[model samples]
Target: MKTTAIGYSENLPAAHPEALLSREVPVPEPGPRDLLVEVEAVSVNPVDVKLRAGAPADGFRVLGFDAAGTVRAVGAEATLFAPGDEVFYAGSIGRPGTNQRLHLVDERIVGRKPTALSFADAAALPLTAITAWEALFDRLRLEEDSAGTLLVIGATGGVGSVMLQLAEALLPDVAVIATASDDARAARMRELGAEHVVNHREDLVAQVLEIAPEGVDRLFTAHSEGQIERYAEIVRPFGHVVAIDDGPRDVSPLKGRSISWHWELMFTRPLLETPDMIEQHRLLDAVADLVDRGRIRSTAATVLGPISPAALREAHELVERGRTVGKVVVHGWEEAIDSARESTDIY
Candidate 1:
């Protein structure tokens, strides 16, 4: 029951990262429908930082959700994965999580990693990709034939990047619009297949109006509450707007346009113990196939450190700043050293 883990003992925000540190703890065993993963790589998300600082100063809180690794053990009821299989998952919000050498994850929420990507790159995709995928395909109900002006707000960040690519690959006929204020970031969005890129700093409605000359059919918001309603202006009547952030705000204005509002929390199924938790497994498998087929590439923007608490805290800080262009990953020390050894002499 003993294992090596990384977590925080005190409550601290990303800005004050010393609060998170590595610790040795008891390893968790897989329960029915769970798999014990020997974690190879993990990624940091803004939620990790928020929960760390916001949560009560209880015992150690393990906060990572995105991970790639090998299965070391499987619960009696687990049939999807077996020992020695390479897997990746965005673990449930309710679980102890993947910021450790070993973790217990529901087998139904995991999938095989893309054989093409590195553990670090693969680690970066799960949480954000799943969030974007479910929001567009599941919540918005965007069909393969759902062609329209699709606008992605905050489109250069991790989730946005993957969402842009997913839209491009699956909905090829749909015109994609992305918001990015910076020149470099806007160019990146275009490279990822956004048909148009606009400045989030300026008037979003005007820019979108100019581009569409009509109205947007779908809007995916990753930024402010103000932006969500602003997007409502650009969406055609009865168009859909989906957001992953569930901050309290008024959506009254959207009602006038009959614009449907949706909230996507990739963790909802696992957190609520939904009967559809297995859907995450299916979605992840689908994404892995896309990755393998080169329809989507890893959006790993940075690699922080081997799985040390100090490194994770730093990664959280970077994410909190709202500046990282893509995903950030950290490897277990063994995997980190091994990666260095195997890489070409490029550094």
Candidate 2:
């Protein structure tokens, strides 16, 4: 059997007509510990844009990472899920992505889809939720009873939205100061339980100091480039900082205060096939429980309609612009469009 997918053959701008194209490709057979899913919905992330821009000319690179779908088949060793299980997961970065109709993902990294959310809503959570969850709990090492001030930089994006919710619900005793550029975003952050909101376009240290007179105990930054000095000033001595973005930087300032910098990538577990790869499954299940219990809500603010080349390209452009407040999802595929696309699938 085959599946239709949107892919780009070469690097190009999102506005270009050929940037994303739909074509037919053979469905991958599941490996041991894998599940073959019939994808129902997907969400776009910054990683999708970054990878699509550098797509090699050799073969098509499918760019989606977050998906909510139904399992159609399971591998010999995949005992975690059955054929009819509804699931959501951020697929491994080492393999083909979740853009295709039928996708193969490791069962250990997948979780049962939250029964309370629609497929599109659930799709928005996996990538951002896993990234934020690991960044706070694993990288920062902050516990539920920990008492301190946390400054969340870039708090309106997909990851930050869920990050704010998770921090608010789990770390109830900790004070959270989230950064936003405008009143609307600030209000949204407040709704998500951020204790204070500061304009990131202004002086961050001054705004942050007004909330916590001494300094923040931890910093969760989505924008890490050229902000180390500011972080060093606002973050208290012996504090920790976790970042998800990468760029050239100097760590000299952090050394004096004993501040530690940590990086988080949700794809690490499945990429290395780590012993704790099943942690993702557990965390996602917890998130599902939270969503069902009304502690957390979906962050999918933009719905771009069905999974066609046009819809996906629009979603990509929205994410690349860096202004979207929450996650953008493209739900369900158009059968007519898929069956009609005749473009050759090279890979």
| Candidate No. with top lDDT | 2
Estimated TM-score per prediction? Answer: 0.94, 0.95
What total of clashing residue pairs does each candidate reach?
1, 0
List residue ranges in candidate 1 displaced over 4 A. 13-17, 334-347
Once model 2 is optimally superposed onto the true structure by TM-score, how far is the C-alpha of residue 316 displaced, in angstroms?
A: 0.8
What C-alpha lDDT do the candidate models reach, one value each?
A: 0.86, 0.90
Candidate 2: segments with Cα more than 4 A from true spot = 336-347
Model 2 per-residue lDDT tens digits across residues 36-88: 99999999999999888885736787778999999999999889999999999
Error of 2 at 153 (Å): 0.3
Report the Cα lDDT for residue 167, model 2.
Answer: 92
